[model samples]
Target: MPRPRYLLALAGLLFAGLAAALASAPRDAGSQVFSPRAVVPMVARDEGAPPPPPATPTPFAPTATPTPRPPTATPTAAQPTPTPRPPTATPTPAPSGLRLQGVNWYVNTTGTIYVMGIVVNGLSTPVELVRINVRFYNASGQLLATDTTYADVSIIPAGGSSPFWTLLLNPPPGVASVEAVLGTYSVSSRPPITGLTPTVTNIYRSSSIALRVVGTVRNDSSATYQFTRVIAAYVDSAGYVIRIETDYLEPSTLAPGQQGTFEAIFFNAPAGLETNNLLIWTTASR
Candidate 1:
């Protein structure tokens, strides 16, 4: 026994409930799916931008300033130069007082000519080492030969004379005249050695080759006289020199007031001579 109206009402309520449930249900799975880009982060970039500068630190302490220095001075005046000097000169000696006198010549048969002359010292001092020059000439005044000779007297006193002789071995032709010249002379400034005398004895012609003369010399001076020399000269009747000879005293020295004997020989004498004259002279050291 159920009623019909109740049945129909129950059917209507069921259909209405079904329709609300269908409208209120969840959506489909295909419509809820997501994209890959939506989960990551992103940034935006600009076109023109300037870079930032590096940072600098500040100083801790203060700085100090530097000081200047002064300048030095220079000198102006310089040193002076020195000067040079000149040299000096020396002087020379003057000529002496001496002269020549009486030149003579003689010829023998053997063509040997003998030349003789005299030297005179006019100065206040004595003359030593006298040299004489003999020049031979012809009748036409042309020079033939020139000869030199020394006086046998080593020292001639003031205002005194000394004899000189030379032998020409072989003379040239036309020798008619001769001239004597004073070649050289030396005067002593020292004091004179005086008081010497010579004596001739035993005089003879020993053959024709020689004339022998023996003599003695005496020294009358106060001082000792050394190296005394004695000379002798022979002349013919015509007053021309024929021969000359020299000799030295023995011991070669004479003390105060001493005498010594000597002998001399002259060679080449002419034969048969009629008359002859002899002269003697003496010299000694100072």
Candidate 2:
């Protein structure tokens, strides 16, 4: 039992190279070990086979599961903002009737300020567009001038009355007192814009026109009037209204019994104006 000597010459040189590779193999080369060119031996395999069975695993070609990659237009975090729409509102208008009755104020001699008025249709119907607002104060109160006037009667007949005036000329240096109210009015059931009918006798005075008026407008109803306004109010001796005028009737149309003629001149009359303390009105329209 003694073996050594290079392991007995390496087992006789691996038994003479496996008998010279079974005498140059082939005769069914041991069934080519499941041939296919003897399963690739590339000229000289120096003994390689087991590693080949692993290659048959290529049947696991299941790599097609990559289709789930579609939601990426650049966004990996932070996203949430969408909500805005709300704004559209406008509706306001509702207020009518309430104060302005016989207010008065006068000042003249160059500062000229008169806020005369009279609007009284104390309900029971009939009233029409009676705007008239005046302000102008300053006796330690502030606010100095603002005037708007209207209401020379276009329809006031329920107790009837209408006449308004407003004027302010260069006043605002502590102009002292004034505040006539009522602005914007309405309560009409029609009828009373009449067909014109006014008459203010004829009066005169002039030292450069300090009051003078003459009027006529007459188209007594049957409808056929037009424009024709002739307002006029010039009282004093304490009735306030020191000259309010609006004239125009040289032919402001009138035809159902025609008659028209108007001429007025009142250069701020005040101090004792008496042509019967005047007040005339006329308005037309069919």
Model 1 stretches astray by more than 4 angstroms: 1-99, 108-111, 236-239, 271-274
Residue pairs whose backbone atoms clash in candidate 2 = none
**Candidate 2 ranges with C-alpha deviation above 4 Å:** 1-106, 109-113, 116-133, 139-150, 154-163, 166-173, 176-184, 197-205, 223-229, 233-243, 246-286
Candidate that would win on TM-score: 1
Q: Over the stretch 101-220, how does candidate 1's per-residue lDDT look in tens digits? A: 444556656777666755666667786777777777776778889888876677788877688888788899877666666666666565555788778767777776666788788887
Q: What is the lDDT, from 0 to 100, of the residue 55 in candidate 2?
A: 35
Best of the candidates, lDDT:
1
- Tens digits of per-residue lDDT for model 2, 53-155: 1133445577567667776687889888868768677777422333344355555566565566666565566877777656665656566677777777788
RMSD (CA, Å), candidate 1 to true, equals 67.0
lDDT of 2: 0.63
Per-residue lDDT value at 195 in model 2? 54
